[model samples]
Target: MGVTEYSAKKLYAHLGFANGRDTMVAEGYRMDVLHVWGTHELSTADLLEWLGEFSPQSVEWIDDSSCTLRCNIIMINESTVLHVLHKLAEPFDRRVALTAMAAVISTMNTHNNGGDFERALRPPKLSPVEGTSDRLMPPCGRWFKSISSPERALCLYLRIAHKG
Candidate 1:
């Protein structure tokens, strides 16, 4: 198995989830595992760079040196396996602007809605690590996966997981 596949297996194993190919079954709900893995070390600059490469619009740093990140909205299932850990116990209020959640009206437009990137955002809940719990469910009822890369410097896990 490739790194991504291995990571997926590890993740499912961590969650005690059963899987077939790209799909994972948890709590009677089937979810597609959109897993990605790499050896990139965790670093604020590198994290921003990767975010810039993937989702750039809502990237904000609470402290660039500290590598704190804030996103407006995300609909992709991001995950990696590594060491350093940082998680948000709670999410921002819907009344709060600047970073609204993205909605999944259709698969194609999951990343954007009506040209607005931030709407109906549901961020990920904190997980001690993989396999320690069932799939982390954000407010939107979608699966959210957050994993660190092999480097332990950066993690691929993002916000908002979508089911195709």
Candidate 2:
């Protein structure tokens, strides 16, 4: 599979941790896997440069095809993965960024019950004073209310998570 397909599958696998057993397994696991793929001309240095501040614990190259190269990056935590996703969004594919975001959100939800995941997914209750307009707001509207942008919200979340 290509980089995008690999990322999507990894995200789905992480989402499966919604089940108790999988969540427990994921909690016990200390490393996160990131797949990076490109033409054979792409080098490890290039990929690492693209990753920016997020450093991987290890990188394993898979030369499965003549024209393409794939690397499995072992990262320290979900936060590092989030950092990588943010970098990817800036220069790489936007879909990869969304996939990574969904994976991290799923991971956060599994770990914390009263986190942004709950707030983002919860349907907003219509305020009697405001009438039914509140119902029209998307579920994530409340989560993003205090944050000026999605990137800022992500940074804020990472900051809070790092503090604890």
Query: Best by TM-score, which number?
Result: 2
Best model number under lDDT: 2
Each model's total of backbone clashes? 12, 0
Residue 44, model 2: Cα distance from true site in angstroms: 1.2
Question: Per-residue error at 105 for model 2, in Å?
Answer: 35
TM-score of each: 0.23, 0.33
Q: Which stretches of candidate 1 lie over 4 Å from their true place?
A: 1-3, 20-22, 25-50, 56-164
Write model 2 residue lDDT over 1-164, tens digit each, in one string: 12354553343344333342345344553225454332135455655454445665655564421111113655666546534544343222335556898888788889987577779877888556554333332222001011222231222111101110
Q: Residues 22-51, candidate 1, lDDT per residue (tens digit)?
A: 444334321312222211334444554554
| Candidate 2 local Cα displacement, residue 5, angstroms | 23
Q: Which window of 10 residues has the lowest lDDT sum in candidate 1? A: 80-89
Clashing residue pairs in candidate 2 (N, C-alpha, C atoms within 3 angstroms): none
